[model samples]
Target: MKAIVITSPGGPEVLQLQDVEDPSIRDDEVLIQVAATALNRADVGQRLGSYPPPKGASPYPGLECSGTILAVGSSVHRWKPGDQVCALLSGGGYAEKVAVPEGQVLPVPEGVSLRDAGALPEVVCTVWSTVFMMSRLSPGESFLIHGGSSGIGTFAIQIAKHLGVRVFVTAGNEEKLAACKNLGADVCINYKTEDFVARIKEETGGKGGSTLMMLSSQLASVWYDISVWCFDAGVDVILDNVGGPYLQRNLDSLNIGGRLFLIGFVGGAVTEVNLAPLLIKRLTVQAAGLRSRSPENKAEIVKEVEKHVWPAIAAGKVKPVIYKSLPLSEAAEGHRLMESSIHIGKILLIP
Candidate 1:
C-alpha cells in the first residue's frame, strides 16, 4: 500500500508518498481498496504538527474515504467482498488499502459516484450527529452557522433547509455568502463586512434557536456578543468545533438550560472558564471526538446516515460541494490548499 506520511510536521512539504505494508483486518473489520479521500481542517492541523493521531491510531492523515471492499473478516456477516462503501475513519484513509470495523462502513447512496463518495462521510456525520441528533434541531427553528462556505457549512445549510429550518450563515466574502444563499441560506452574513451577531438578531427579531461555529481566536473575544445576537435569551443549542477561550463564551451565550457540544479545537487548547456561569445558565457542556467512539456508537451513526443522510443524496436534495480534486500523490497539495483557506468546500485526493 502507498500512503502519504508526514516525516516532521511544519508545512505541506513534509508530506511524502511511500510504499507501506497493507493493513491487516481484525476479525470484526473489513479491508477497503480506497478510491478517494477527502480533506478537512483537521488534516491541516495534522500537517502542521498541532494535531496527531490518537494512541494506537493510524499515522496517515485522511479522516474519511470511499472505496470497495476487498476482504471481510469472519465476524462481518452483513457485508461481503466487492461491496462499494464509504467510511468514517480514525486515520489511515490516505492509502490504497485500510481496514475498519464493519459497522463503520456504509453503502454508497444511489446515483453517487465511487470517487465522489469521499465527500459524504465526515460532513454528513458531523452535521447529522451534531445538528440533528445532539441539538435536536426542529422545523421552523432559526439556525446560524459560521464559515457558511465551508464543507460542513454547505452540507449543514442544505440539510437544515430541507428540514424546514430558516438558515443564517457568516462567511468572509460576498462570493462565499452567495454560495451559501444558493445552498438555501436565508440570511448570509459577510463577517468581513458585517457583524453576524447584529444581523442574526435583526433577522430573527431575537428568537434565534441554534448556532454552529468553527472555533477561532477572534470568535472567542466576541463570544458573548455573538450569543447576544440570538434574541429571546440567546441560542438554545450550539455546536462548537473550535475550543479554547471560546469554551467560556459558549457557556455564556447559551440560554438557560441550553447545551453546548464541543467536537474540535482548531485554536490552541488552553482556556479559562467560569464555573459560576455554568451553574447560573444550567448549561450542559460536553467535549467529545467522533473517531474514538465505540463500535456500537459508530454503528448508530451509520444507521442515522442510512435513515437521514442517504435519501437526500439519492434524491439530489443534498449535493457534495467539492472545491477541487487532485491526484493521490498530491496529498501534500491537498493539505496546502486547505491551509490557504481559499476553497469553499472539500478538497479531494483521488487515487
Candidate 2:
C-alpha cells in the first residue's frame, strides 16, 4: 500500500507518497481498501509539526475516509466484506488501506457517492457532537459559526438551518460569504473587511442567542474581542475549535451557566486564561478531540451521527460540500489548498 508520510514535517513539500505495509486489524476493527479521503486543517498542522498523531494511531495524517470493506475482524458483526462504508479515522486515511474500529464505520448514505462520503464523517461528527450534543442548540435559537464557507462551517450552517435555527457566519470575502448565504446562512459577515461582532449584534438585534461555533484559525487573535461581544449579546454555549489565547475569552463570552466546548488548538496550544469569568459566571469549559478518543467513545459519536445526521444527508436537507478532488498522490496539493483557505468546502483525495 502507498501512503502519505510526513518526513520531518515542515511544509506541503515535505509530504511524500511512499509504499508501506498494509495495516492489520484488531478483533473489533475492519480493514478497508480506501476509495477516497479528505484533507483537513489537522492534516496541515501535522504536516507542519504543530500537531502529532495520538499514541498508537497510524503515522499517516488522514482523519476520515470512504471505502469498501476488504476484511473484518472476528468481533465485527455490523459489516462484512464488500460492504460500502465511510469511517471516522484516527489516522491513515491518506493510504490505500486502513484498519478502522467497527464503531467508527458508517454505511454510506443512500444517495451519496462513495467518494463524497469521505467528506461527511469528520464534519458531521464535529458539528453534531459539538453544536447539537454538547452545546444543545435547539430550534428557533440563533447560531453563529466562524469561517462559514469552511467544510465544518458549511455543514454547520445547513444543519442549523434545517433544524430551524437562524444562522450567522463570518467569511473572508464576498464570494465565500455568498457561498455561505446560499447554504442558508441568514447573516454573512465579511470578516476581512467588516466587524463580525457589530454585524452579528445588528442581525440578532443585540441578543446573539445561545450557541456560537468557532472554526476560524484566526480566533486566537480576536477571541477576547469576540468574547466581550458575546458577553453583551448573551451567548451561552460556545463550540470552539481554536484554542490557546481563546480559552480566557471563551470563558468571558459565556453568560452565567454557559458551557464552552473546546475541540481544537489550531492557533496555539499555550496561553494565559483569566480565572475570574469562570468563577463569577459559573461557566463550564470542556475539551474534546475525536482522534484521541477511545473507540467506545468514537462509536457513540458515530452512532449519534448516523442516527441523526445521515437522515438529513439522505433526504437532501444537508449535503457534503466538496471543493475539489485530486488523485491520492497529490496529497501535498490537497494540503496546499487547505492551508491557502481559498476553497469553500472539503477537498477530497481519490485513492
Candidate 3:
C-alpha cells in the first residue's frame, strides 16, 4: 500500500507519498480501502514532530477516514466486506488502507456521500462527546463555541441548534462569520474586531443581569435600555479549542454554573489566569483528546453519535461541511491549507 510518510520533522514539504507495507488487521479490527480522509490540526502537529501517534496506533498522520470494508477480523461482527463506512482512527488515514477497530466504524448517514463521510467522524464525535454528552447542554440553554466557522464550529452550531440551544460563535472575519450564521449560529462575533466576551455578555444578559428576570415587569425598560444594560450577561456553556489565551475570557464568559469543554490548545497551552471567576461563577473546566482514548471508550462515543447525531444528519438538519478535496498524494498541500486557516471547513484527501 502507499502512504504519506514523514521524511522528517519539518515543514509540509516533508510529507512524501511512498510505498509501505500493507496493514494487517487484529482479531477485532476491520481493514478499509480508504476513499477519503480529512485534515485536522493534530495531523499538522504530528508532521511538525510536536505530536506523535499513541503506542500500537498506525504511524501515519490521519486520525479519521471514510472507506469500504475490504476485510474484517475473526472477532469482528456487525459489518462485512463491501460495507461502506466511516471511522474514527488513531492514525494511518493518510494511506490507501487503514485497519480500524470494528467498534469505531460508523455507517454513512443516509444523505451524506461516502466521500463527505470522511469529514464527519472526527468533528462529530469530538463535539458530541465534549459538548452534549459531557457538558449536558440542554435546549433553551445558550452555548458559545469559538472558531465558529471551523470544522468543529460549523458542525457544533447545527447540532446545537438541532437540539434547541441558542448558539454563539467567534470567527476572524465577516466571510467566516456569515458562513457560521447561515449554518444557524444565533450570535456571530468576529474575534478580530469585536470583544467576544462583551458580545456574549450583552446577548445572554449575565447571571446577575438576566433579561428574562425582568422580561415581564420591565419589558418597556428593556426595550429602552437594551443596549446599555445588555452587556453583562453570560452563556450557559462554552466549547473552546483555543486554550491558554482564552482561559480567562472563557471563564468570564460563562454563566453561574457554566461548563467549558476544551478539545485543543491551538492558541498555546499555557497561560496565567485569575482563578477568582471560577469560584464566582461556579464553573466546570474540562479538557480532553480523542486520539489517546481506548477503543472501548471511543466505541461508546461512536454509538451515542449514531443514536442521536445520525438522525439529525439523515433528517437534513445537520450536514458535512467540506471545503476542498485533494488527492492523498497532496497531503502536504492539505496541511498547508489547514495551517493557512483560509478554508471555512474540513479539507479532504482522496486516495
The 0-to-1 C-alpha lDDT of every candidate, in the order given, reads 0.79, 0.83, 0.91
**Every model's TM-score:** 0.86, 0.87, 0.93
- How far residue 8's Cα lies from its native spot in candidate 3, in Å, is 0.9
Ordered from best to worst TM-score, the candidate numbers read: 3, 2, 1
The lDDT, on a scale of 0 to 1, for candidate 3 is: 0.91
lDDT of 1 by residue, 148-253 (tens): 7888888889988888887777788888888999999888877678755555545645554444333333554665312222224545566666678557656655
lDDT of 2 by residue, 20-74 (tens): 9999999999999999999988888788887799898999999999999999999
User: Which candidate, 1 or 3, would have the higher lDDT against the true structure?
Assistant: 3
- For this target, which candidate reaches the highest TM-score against the unseen true structure? 3
Better of 1 and 2 by TM-score: 2
True lDDT of residue 134, candidate 2 = 80
**How many pairs in model 2 have backbone atoms within 3 A of each other, for residues 3 or more apart or on separate chains, i.e. clashes?**
0
- Name the best candidate (by lDDT): 3
Q: What residue runs in model 2 are displaced by over 4 Å at the alpha carbon?
A: 207-232, 244-258, 269-283
Task: Report the number of backbone clashes for model 3.
Answer: 4
- Worst ten in a row by lDDT for model 3: 223-232
